[model samples]
Target chain A: MVLWIGGRAQGKLALAMQKWPEAKILDVSETDAKGKEELLRSLEDALKDERLVWNHFHLFVRRALLLGMEPSEIWEKVASFVDERPDLVVICDEIGNGIVPMEPEERRYREETGRMLCKLAAKADCVERIFCGIPVRIK
Target chain B: MMILIVGGSGCGKSAYAEKRIMELSLDGAMRYYLATMQVYGEEGRRKVQRHVELRKNKGMLTIEQTRDVSEALPKMQEGSKVVLLEDLGNLVANEMFGEDGAMTPWEIVADKIVMQLRQMNSSLDHLVIVSNNVFEDGIDYEEGTRDYLRALGMVNAELAGDATQVVEVVAGIPLMVKGKE
Candidate 1:
């Protein structure tokens, strides 16, 4: 899997689109996957074909968390989906770089997002970090 | 030489900075961790404790200076060759809002901080600064927050230009934005 991660407005989506003009784009930033099963189903449908760009994967994780899905459960679904289709590109915003929030739920969401991103980075075949519209490949 | 590390909280910026400073520190050279956060409540103490724990056994001295970045210089002037400023956000906040901080305008605050950092950097062989990426949240904050952001943005821009290395840590991975390996 190819993973593109960066802060908001760093042009991760733009870079991904430019790099894979022929790929199908699936932006789940506004997805309300109410539960683990729904999220997994969405992922399965999205990863049915190769050359797919999964945008805002981090928000999907947050939605899953809010819908009462544990981090392990979310990771299991993502890992299986990506393992089945390794030829996919993912773009996620780096959300854990700001100050920790006062709300406990926000803090947990931030932590889980970062943790899951690390796991994804480890499994990814190519990892590039976007900064100021520039791509820096670290893995 | 100066190195700047920028990232979101818990993104392994401190870890990366610590490891980098350790690598840059020569044998027997003094190392100082310039902590800029002012501990107050339980949460504050816990955060400081966590950082202290991280630096445990790292053979580095810890100096707490919440405001006036240059004030910590005298204490480190005694042969300290390497220093790591844990962060610039808190330092900026303290200067802008702290009771004993400089209550001047954001531009003045930014100038003061940049000047202090330059003075401090001039005396050290290596200075590794850890800063935040607080501008991406897209939230329209209040005037105070905007001012704080402006000051931090200016300081980061100025120092980054002078830094020999600038890295943004993402999930424990360091992506070099400036300078070579």
Candidate 2:
């Protein structure tokens, strides 16, 4: 698993595409996976392919939180999928840089997203941070 | 040498920048803290005060120039070796929106800021600039906020291009994006 992290519109997706042109690009942002079972099923299906670009994995966390699903539980499902697929590339935007949201749920989403990204980054075979469309391999 | 230190809010970029500037300074070399923020209320005042306290006994002078940053250049001492501009976000915002609440074209503001920063870099021995990662939030702000983000994004790109070194501090960990120590 290769974890690609960057700020919004920093070309994380473009880099992923450039690296894996023939890979399946599954944008989690467009996924309507509301409940845990739906999300797990969607993720499992996406990972079944040879190479898959999971764009906006952060949005999955947001959706999970919206559906009152625990972040750890979501991570468990994601971890299992990642463990099964070595050709998975997860792209996430770094959304924890801004001011903390005043809304409680928004704040929780940010925190959960950050934690999930960290865990993924630690376990991934490679981690790259994109800044201004420049890819820097951090791990 | 111009160093650009970037990071998220309260991620220790300021503290790290301060230490870096101090390390870069020579004995008897003049140091200036170019404060770009304009205090609006009690919270702002308290934040400024905290920064002031942090820099106390650091042998550095604070220059408050909310807008027209280049104007501060002429006032700097001849022996000034290092100047740490604590932020570029507030500077860009102030230039776009004046004290009287007038809005200026963001392109012009961004250009002016880049030009001013270039001038500062040319004049100073070591310039340590601090900037924030303003664009990662998914919230679709109003048009004005979006414009501000675009402007800031442009400014940051320019700064990074011109900088001799670029570092992003995350959780107090400085990740070198460009250039060596």
Best by lDDT: 2
Error of 1 at A18 (Å): 27
Consecutive 10-residue window with the lowest summed lDDT within model 1 chain A:
A27-36
Best by TM-score: 2
**What DockQ does every candidate get?**
0.08, 0.25
Candidate 1 per-residue C-alpha lDDT over A30-92 given as tens digits, one digit per residue, 9 for 90 to 100: 556666677667777776665899998878877788888888988888898788877988888
Q: Ten-residue segment with the worst summed lDDT in candidate 2 chain A? A: A7-16
Each candidate's lDDT (Cα)? 0.82, 0.83
Q: B82, model 1: CA deviation in Å?
A: 0.4
Error of 1 at B114 (Å): 0.8
Q: Go through the candidates in order and give the clash count of each.
A: 2, 0
| CA deviation > 4 Å runs, candidate 2 | A1-3, A9-92, A96-127, A132-134, B41-56
Q: Is the docking of candidate 1 incorrect, acceptable, medium or high quality?
A: incorrect
The residue-level lDDT of candidate 2 at B107 comes to 79
Candidate 2, B1-181: lDDT as tens digits: 8998988788999999988999888666788999998898999899988877667678888888998898988888786578999788899888888768888887788799999889878988889999988788767588777777767777776787788888989999998888888
Screening candidate 1 with a backbone cut-off below 3 angstroms (N, C-alpha, C), the clashing residue pairs are: A97-B8, A97-B9
